[model samples]
Target chain A: MCCESDQPSLTQAGHRRGQIQLLAALSAIVLVWCGLLPALGRTTVLRQRIAFLEARGVNPSAKFFTEQEAGWRNAAEVERQLQEHPQAFWALPWRHR
Target chain B: MSQQSRQVSDDSLAMIAAGLMLAVSLCCTALGSTGGGGAAEAAASAWQNPLSALLKLPKSWESNPFAEVSGWLPGVVGSQLLLGAALVVGMLICRVRTGEFLLPFLKVFLLSVLAYVLAEQKVVKYYGLEYALWALLIGLLISNTVGLSGRLRPAVRTELYMKTGLVLLGAEVLFGKLLALGLPGICVSWVVTPVVLIVTFWFGQRVLKIESAALNMVISADMSVCGVSAAIATAAACRAKKEELTAAVGISLAFTVLMMVVMPPLIQLMGLGPVVGGAWVGGTIDSTGAVGAAGAMLGAEAEKVAVTIKMIQNMLIGVVAFGVAVYWVTYVERTEGTRPDISEIWRRFPRFILGFLGASVLISLLYENLSDGAGFVKAVVDGGTKTMRSWCFCLAFVSIGLETDLRTLSRFLRGGKPLVLYVCGQALNLLLSLLMSLLMFEVVFPEAADVLRK
Candidate 1:
């Protein structure tokens, strides 16, 4: 019963097919990633800006982003605001409001 | 292939993975970014972008491709595949009969995607019909209608998926945030949550005399803590049946919907300040998403206070899960005339909890020390973990549905004791949470409340 020859053909076939399916699924995912890596390069740049702003103690809310983009608030001012109201900087919603 | 050896190996793998994550997280903290004292990010209630598909409805499709999709569609899908492969690899490492996991895993994944897509619908998102409930319902529909086939049985790993997710979830339970609002937040969340859970469990056992103590405990934890997540964790800790867990989740989600709708308006009518109002909803509501919604309806201040309070309450699940595991092993499942020793308890105690706590402590400390604060945590740590965790939970819920015979669940509902148990527990929760919130915010720590107001 412990031997490979003892195992039924149907069971062996099923196992083989399942392994192949798993690999195939994984391959498809890899292929998709390969296709989109270039597109993702631009997105990564935006993410880096977000990270830089966050590193400067700026709140990363949409409002903060808009303000920064419009030159209404700079990193220094945002940092000051964070110092005064730490909780306010992190008061974004966990989910959709 | 003895059960004991299998258990040891499985637990060993979990512990190793957990330890590795903690160590890596600590290293990341040492190499932390230079972002000042801005707060670190914790796991949010729902995914910021839940849906990720190439084909979008015409109305959703915008002019720019980047704007239309979330910039990197492949990254999202590839990341998910990586998570799936990781889990499968973990199972295989533990000698979980490799080829058998694929079809069932695929089924669960497909169901979860469907649940996510359904949750993405405008109306569903508004009502907060989360993927947890949808996954369970859809799985239930398939099982009850066509019935789960033999091929699916090999992949139905509800406990495994849940345990993995819980361990990942542990990273998000930042202890530093517990002191964010100071002593008042601690008293309201930590104090009220345990009291309500204890009282509810006692009520179920002594007063209600429910047949399954595990079911009672699961429901109590679910109703008093953070809904589905709590239910899954507690169920695993106490070794509750799949059907019983399902029933508890069903009851929780039903009341969660009602409470989310009713609580905000009631708080408004009572003329509670945003801090008091948010704390009330945060402490009482079972679901984190619903708590956010209820708070949002009140105001921005309320939303902030409520979500923060709920985050505090969320931390209690680890303690509650550990306590339940200890209690069940020592008191509930002890053999007559023989007290289990420390080693016995250690053996019986759920190993995943060690993983869970380890992850929490690691990530919490990492968050505290790290610079770019929430941004780095959100983008790097939580971003990867959240995707994996969501998949694990979705798969777990689906597996639960597949394994559960609706008939068994219906049997539990026959006397409506579970419903009564949930309702009564919720009632106590509401009253106690409200009183605790009022006393802490209004009387004991008015300054903290003022800070919240600011």
Candidate 2:
């Protein structure tokens, strides 16, 4: 009589274990899908804000410095100086007035 | 059949398999060599033969006595070829003495060093792939049949090599770089790591029902956090089973290779600026070398962001390793009725990591003191350190391959849980990294974005 009573409980425990395994597998799948896929279609609004700050003279953290930034600064400074005085460089070295 | 007869059959079969694999490895090497036809042929013709290269040595009389000794000593020796030979010799000795074939760790290190040198010299364009593939081939042959039949020792050796390599790698991490991304980078790494780890682990256990907790943890960490290096570090700390390590590595390598090839194109297609793209790639990709490559391909800005982000993430490895070790000891081992003493913890702990920390501290101190002189010193140190780390890792990988049999790995797949866990965790890493990069880099650091655009 006792053995007969325990059979259902034993089967239920086994079922619960199987369910836990299934849930773990599903969570893993969900996590991967979330990580790899892009969150939205286009650049987030935050990216645009960053671009705006970058256009100004302010520097980002030193770690984030890209070679392109150096190039841009160099070119922009040259163009600005040229615009400031459309005349003569032969007689004197160029400097920002 | 009698037990004696079965044992004999197994041994004979193992020998036959080993012989076949060795032949295959040799064939692959020959084919690879021949494939490089023109340049290889030209170089071969112009240079002295391999024998001459072996025979030629720097004149001992030309250098200071100290320098000569330094040059002669195997520990300080710089020659990749010599290192390879030493590794082979070491493995052979171990095999003879123990009656077990262990994967030749030293040989892999040598080959990796060779690859790095070749790449630095522009002799080969893809150093990581070349070395990884080579190590894989050689490692596969040895581990599968010929090497040590016993499991525990090889696993221990591999862990030792990895930890030591990590410690040496510490010197290369500049504290200044860590401060570069400043608080944002730190926050991202700190926040993202636990979330990913917890979620992945939960999935591995509750959902996937992976029987081995160690394997589950490794896969979760590898995919959600840093990849093979992270996996190895964590696995060693936890004293994970050999099968678990193999699975983690397999997953990491597969994803890393795919990401390396696909990421640059994806960035371009999305029209994301270099900075955003690079940060995303760095955060998502498994391998540091692959991250750098992908970043470089994208643009200069991309390279900077990718490398910076990756380095920041890499720095977290030490902390993660420590945590894993603690967890294993305090929670897992303790629950199992094994009260681990502090000494046992120290014994199980990968000591070489201390070396890595020491190297980092030393380098940082030198940099602070030298300032202007730091550049030249950094270059030399960087070159040497990178060479060493690459070699060590390659050796470890080769050892792994040598010990592993494809059949064994396939048998592991019967559970089908690891594959699911890997894919899920990696996917999560990719998305989380992208979200964080977009928000932190794009929104928070607009100046960086503008600079990248220009």
Candidate 3:
């Protein structure tokens, strides 16, 4: 089964064509089944969730200060105070506080 | 019209099959493009804050493109002429490559099954079937159908396709974030993998006495380290025969599917915490995508833990590949009288892995130097890499399905030893990981555990 045949017939071509059609149909069904349909469902669900959050006035994307962020802020403040009052910074009541 | 005439007919049939396989591959690519592109556009709309958008779209979409595709198909199918046109073009490509249609055709079917299972189970909130399934299937198809009992010339196209896919896969390996698991994650993976490999190899050889060292190693690496991707990397490095590669992939995929379906509920039943559960699942499960799905089923925390753990494991590919290459050359090649030179090592080394590492390193450097600019670029790059990787994997699956014969696969199952080996190894992985996570994190090292909690 390794050689080419002479003068391909209409029937052979038709057979090949039919196979391609079947495959294409199957692929389309799968594409929709696996990809499109579920995506639609998710979009609906997400939209609902977004709407609900908006209604509740809760920003889904709100940024809350993390401990790391707080630490950075604290560090910057300490540095600023140190730059302002080099030696006697530790003596101040506010600095001690 | 005697023997020559019959030979001619056989050739024609083979040609027809080849043509069909090619057609199906083209169609799959087209369908994937349409489905993928439509999803991308919708995801772009969802990408309001590019950095946040990247996190939302690519992570979610990569985890499950079907969900994304479904969301956009309803509204955009009409307005997005490009999607429809792309779909049509994909169909036409399938038509032209009609002879080799069965492989990709089977893949679309398998992908559908996986997608349905994922959605029905809600394994991951938005993820569909694992992309690794597609890759495994394509690898099997190519090795079996196109590469089987054929002249080198006939198989050239398929091999070219396989190599190209591997190269593209390299682009997906982002080096920087791979280190996020820190030294602990890396240490765990490195320690566990070699132990598993050593045990499995010993069992395969001394205990089971399997004739093929190559087969033993391939299966061991696949089962112990990762799945088909690991098998392929190791197989290439070891210069294993095509049959060995095929057998290892087939075995790995079968177990992976079973594990993906079984592990989630098992974890829930065991009442394992997210960190423990994620570590257990990540260490035991063969496929990364499936691990994510299984983790997602547990909870967001579990998903994060599982994915992070698996990412660390995935990063081990480079180390494992290099080690295997060195071992194979020094040990196996020396005894086998096929010692390869340095150039051969370069040739045999799956080059795309370099791309994966390169992309990862570049991303890391960018993130370090330009933290603000890094996120946006990383997002786009991640999206592109994921798309390409998935496509390459899908194509490989199609190739595998076309090449495989069910009878041959069944013949290998006469003895239940391989199955037993896999189960035992996986159980060991679960127990080991669970113990480590519990003792090291929860009790002994609460400080480290706190890092995960955050």
Candidate 4:
């Protein structure tokens, strides 16, 4: 009779353990999604900057520090652009600057 | 198989796989197809998909939408998943039980993915907050807050990730590039750096009386060599406690930020031209990112000089890692009575340094022999292996955070000796780098500076 009574409780415990495992997996997935927030925001900014550069007739691909019109000379200039429109500045490749 | 044997077997397999990947990449680079344009386009396109943009999914996903859709991406995330799966298979092959490892490995993957995304954020990127720092911070937050569950234990393989990353980093260190700055560049980076490293380490040991010699070495290397990367290499070689590595890294990063912002303006005020300023900033700054950012502030000439000097200094990573490994095996862990045999030293030596050296030499040979091989090397190694290396480093930092207790770090900070060591080392580094830069670039090798200016 004792063994018979323990069966239902044992099943319940097993079910609970499964639930915790599932919850842990779900928690991890959620954390991953939330972490993407910053990258998503940055990407959006990069896209806008590319579009702005295209409109300005500036070849974003030109050798960095070579062209006088579009080329950035120093970090101060880059910082100024970033301050004004961060997406554009960050969108430019490291070599392009 | 026993757990110890299983671990050894798994590590050996990882080493082989890493070697194979490097060999194949080098061959691909030699075939006149480094895939630079394609890779860059793929990288730029990666920012298009919201999920990938946020997650920084592998470049493989850009070519195959199915991979992204199925969530089986192949670059950084894929490589880590594959590594985990391979370990599981290795266990199965060895006839070991693997039931407990699955959930913990999954947890590690999730955390690493999250850390990668955080690192990709604009503000973080602007500030040069690397994935390593973010991974460590996030892991610390999770462990200290919710606490690491029992299931997470299997996944926190910090040392494994670090060793693997170091091996991959070896491929990126091309000795040929050291000649770009010529002899003057060598003097500033090679000559002064070791002098500062030895002197600072001695100061820490004799004067500061720092308790952990490993910690002192790590700080000295980080300050005198290449910042965070140097700290990681030296700490691994000397078998530093996780908390000690953390303390050293924290100090380095904090000062890196301050120096990056403050140094450029100070250089301007000191009436240093772009060439001199660039060389000084590049040689002295703790972090490479900071070096570039600081040099960029001065102008393009400064930026060029800065990168060249930093590249020369980066060549020292292999030398420093090997030297530390040898020092540790010979002096620190010496078995008092008997002469240390070759076999014993080989056993005690960090095998990853061999992998690092092998990768460096192979790539250097390619750069020497092949036409436009530098481009190929940059394309294949930078685009492929370097990305994976970043992930490995991020994962390692995450593991460090998960394994560390806040109290453990706080206890190490009690006397603040490590802090003093870093500050003194950096101060000496600054004074020496300035003197050396002026002597080499301005006084001795002004022609090299002029060439860089043009």
Give the residue spans of candidate 4 off by over 4 A: A1-97, B1-14, B27-77, B81-103, B336-339
Which candidate would rank higher by lDDT, 2 or 4?
Answer: 4
Clashes of each: 2, 28, 45, 0
| Alpha carbon lDDT at B87, candidate 1 | 59
TM-score of 4: 0.75
Predicted candidate 1 versus true structure: per-residue lDDT over B1-454, tens digit per residue: 6655655555555555434433443344335433334342343211222222311211111123234345444544554565556656666666666687676667667677655554433334445566677677767665654556678877666666777777877876666666555566777788889999999999999999999999999999988888887888898888887778888888887788788889888998899999899889888888776776667678766866776677667777788888998999899989998899999998877788889988878667765675544444443343355555666777778877766666666877889999999889989998998898888777765655666665
Q: What level of docking quality does candidate 4 show?
A: incorrect
Q: Pick the candidate with the highest lDDT.
A: 4
lDDT of 2 at B22: 25
Using TM-score as the yardstick, the better of models 2 and 3 is 2
Candidate 4 chain A: worst 10 consecutive residues by lDDT?
Answer: A1-10
- Model 2 residue B243 CA deviation (Å) reads 3.5
